[model samples]
Structure formats: structure tokens, C-alpha cells
Target: MDNQTKQTVSQIPLLTTKAGPRDGDKWIERMKEEYTSLIKYVEINKKSDNDWFNIESNQMGTRWQGKCWYIYNFKKYEFDFEFDMPITYPETAPEIAIPELENKTEKMYRGGKICLTVHFKPLWARNVPHFGIAHALALGLAPWLAAEVPHLVENNMIKDK
Candidate 1:
């Protein structure tokens, strides 16, 4: 194998062992490449450290707000909670959890594993192989955050109204 190909192969095990599914090797490589580019973009743009958002694991699957934002209860009809994203990227969907809510759980589906539709679906679809991790995360997370913020939605609507 060529040196580049050998290097790629060597990296696969490390990613797969942590995430799972050999199919994710390609996705992981793409993420690594994209992350490098994103880092460069941030640096070139001279982005402020505060501009970057932080999301912890444990709150991966569901939608939540800032460190102490609200979440959708769906049960008590309350959607006020804070959540974080999962650790695994591209390969596995994040696991969203509500630390304040008892018996609260965020999963992809009923008895399903954590899998972000925007992240994993496009990656697996044969017709769409051009999507990358950073792009997917940006698209999905942005909408999710907007949805969780009623004031933001209300402000936008009022401006339109």
C-alpha cells in the first residue's frame, strides 16, 4: 500500500475501536480533514475564543439550551433543561440527557442507538457522499438551537409581523 493509504488504514482502528462500525472509517477520515480546515478557518478569521460554543457529552441526543437552558419535557409539558452533545462524532449519534429531570433520557428512537439523522444518514447514503461532519453539525445544531429558543423565534416572528 502507498504510504498515505497505509497511514489512513492505521488510523481506522483507533477511530473504529472507540466509535464502532468499520463503515465509519471513511467518515472519520473526512471529519479529521474537515476539522483541520475548520481550525484553520477559525484561526484565519481571528475568531474570539468566546465565539466558539461548548456542548458536553451526556446531552447528545436531545435539544437543550445554554449551560442552564430549558428542554422539552414532552411529559410534564415542560421543556426547560440544559443539555450537551455526545462525544462520538460522525459514527455514533450523541446521547442527550437532562441532569435535572428524573427518568429523563434522550435517544435516537425507541430502543434505538444514538444516531443523528443529518450526520449519519447522509454519510451512509450512497447518493450523497459529499457531506462532512462539520457541515452536518453546523446545519443540525443551528436549527436545533433555534427551535429550542422560543424568544428567538418570537423575536423573528414579531419582526416579520
Candidate 2:
């Protein structure tokens, strides 16, 4: 019916793939409904061109240092990515690695590929909805990085204690 509806309909199939056999189809329908609501929220909250957030579009991805959830030097490590969702909303996780730290940590797995434990898991164990990517990145992955590898912040060493 509308562009937003079309996008939500399209995302249903992508979300379905992430579900298991018993609940996949039902989950897809539910996600499609939820995505429709999310689309409406985004549309209603669309910023004016003169708004500060909209005016700063050019600086969207640059590094900021006030309060980092997680910090790693992308220069030292390069990543290759693939995703099933649109570029604006990537559904799949990217792979990441650095040569020196390849074998020293559990976070990246032994093969040097970034794992997606937080990505696919439910947000709350109770009846609440999933927290999506931003929350997962902030709450789960960021804390995991800080706790599992404190040396990354202290000395940039994989094994420093």
C-alpha cells in the first residue's frame, strides 16, 4: 500500500530465516506487524531538514570519544561484511579480525570470525520483545568486551593481565 508497508513486507522473509522450524512462519508474521509499527514511528518522528540531527548527516559514522560503548582500532583489524537486510538495516552480522590477535581471544572464535551470539538471541527471557541491534550492542556485546578482555582498554594486548 505504501513504501513503508512494502519494506515491512519485504523484511518478513528475512526475519523468517532467523527463526526455527516450529515457529518460523508465525514469527515472520509477528515481525511484519511489529516492523509496520516501527516504520510508522520512524515516519512520524522524521526530522525536519533544519533539525540538528538531520543537519549533521555527513558526520553520522565518524568516531566520537565522549562515552564509547566499545572501542577497537579498525585500522589494525579489517572486516568483511555480508547481510540479508537493506544497507540501512543490516540483519546479518559482519566478520571481523586482526592478524596478531587472531589466536589469542575467545570473542572472535578460533577462526578469526566474529560470532553472533548476541545478535540472534531474544532480548528478554520473559515475555518481552527483543531489544534489536542497538540495545544488543550496548548492553550485551559492549559489556562482554569490557569484561572478557579488559586489557584491550588498558594496554591493547590480547592477553595482558
Candidate 3:
């Protein structure tokens, strides 16, 4: 990458984790359940319908990094995001972020982790075992996009589709 094209990212605050012991076996069990439900929800909501959104997850270690699309005003916009799990597993919700939109908003961390400072995190904490990628997408990213994307489009910060 050329120096002229190099990106400059501003630091954004991350979610501070609550103190807890790390359990590998528990993490394994939670990940399995989460991924299963995530796939099922995506298949049912995205694949089975003619909706304005779709997602396909490709696992990479503890993260679910994949393609996601949203149709706005009859145009499709495709982007990539990752759901990176912290060591705390179910004790803390995975950091779901759109790397492509980095530095565009204060709502996201410099590393592209979306800041779930609102009800999203609290809700997930309340239903740790049940909350998964699907819940994060539905309750977190989807709503964030619905709100922020429009502002981004208006300012030409991002393309609307």
C-alpha cells in the first residue's frame, strides 16, 4: 500500500469485560450452539426470503468472518464483517464489526469492532447462553446500519444501496 493511501484509524473505546474465569470447554459448547443457531437463523431469515439482507459465514478460528449484504433503495451493497469472540466467551458478546466502515463513525472501535454500548450489550448479557451471532446481527448490526447508513449516504461517507 502506498503511503498516500494508507488509512489512519482513530481510537474508539471497547467494551470492558466483567471479571470471570476463562473456560475452554464452556467456550466450545457456547460456540457450537451459537454457530448452529446463527446458521439456522440466517437460512430462515435471509436465504428463505426475498429480504434486503443476506449473510454467509465462513469460520476462521474463533471468529465468524464473512460476507453480508444489504439492499437499500433497490440497490445492493455488499460488505465484510467479523464476529470475533473475546476470551471470556459467553460472558461477553462477540465483537461484531464492519471493517470496511472503519474510522467513519465514533460508534466503532479503531479495529472495526462496533461499540455495543446501548441496550444491545445489556440484552446479550442477560441472555448469554441464548444470544449468538444471529442475535447480535438482528439486534445489533442491523439496527446500527438502519440508522447510521442513511447518515453516511447523505454525507457521501459511504455509498447507499
For model 2, state the Cα shift of residue 84 in Å: 6.7
Give the Cα lDDT of each candidate.
0.34, 0.34, 0.62
Residue-level lDDT of model 2, residues 27-130, one tens digit each, is: 45534543444444334334321110111101321111111223344222222222122122223222232334455566666554334465323332221233
Candidate 3, residue 82: Cα displacement in angstroms equals 1.0
Off by over 4 Å in 3: 1-26, 47-61
Q: Which ten residues in a row have the lowest lDDT in candidate 2?
A: 49-58
Between 1 and 2, whose TM-score is larger?
A: 1
User: TM-score per candidate, in order?
Assistant: 0.34, 0.31, 0.73
Of the two candidates 2 and 3, the one with more favorable lDDT, higher being better, is: 3
Model 3, position 103: C-alpha lDDT score: 94
RMSD of each: 12.6, 13.0, 11.5
Write candidate 3's Cα lDDT for 49-153 as tens digits.
634344554443365677666666765667788865677766677788789899988888978877787868887788755555666776677677777776676
For model 1, how big is the CA root-mean-square deviation?
A: 12.6
Candidate 3, number of clashes? 1
Q: TM-score: which is higher, 2 or 3?
A: 3
The worst-scoring run of ten residues by lDDT in candidate 3 lies at 4-13
Residues 1-161, model 1: lDDT tens digits: 24632333233212122332233565355445544544443343233332233332222222324332323222111222243333444344433333333222232334322234654355334312333333333333333433433543344421111
Candidate 2, pairs of clashing residues:
none
Error of 1 at 152 (Å): 9.8
> Candidate 2: which stretches are off by over 4 Å?
1-101, 110-129, 153-161
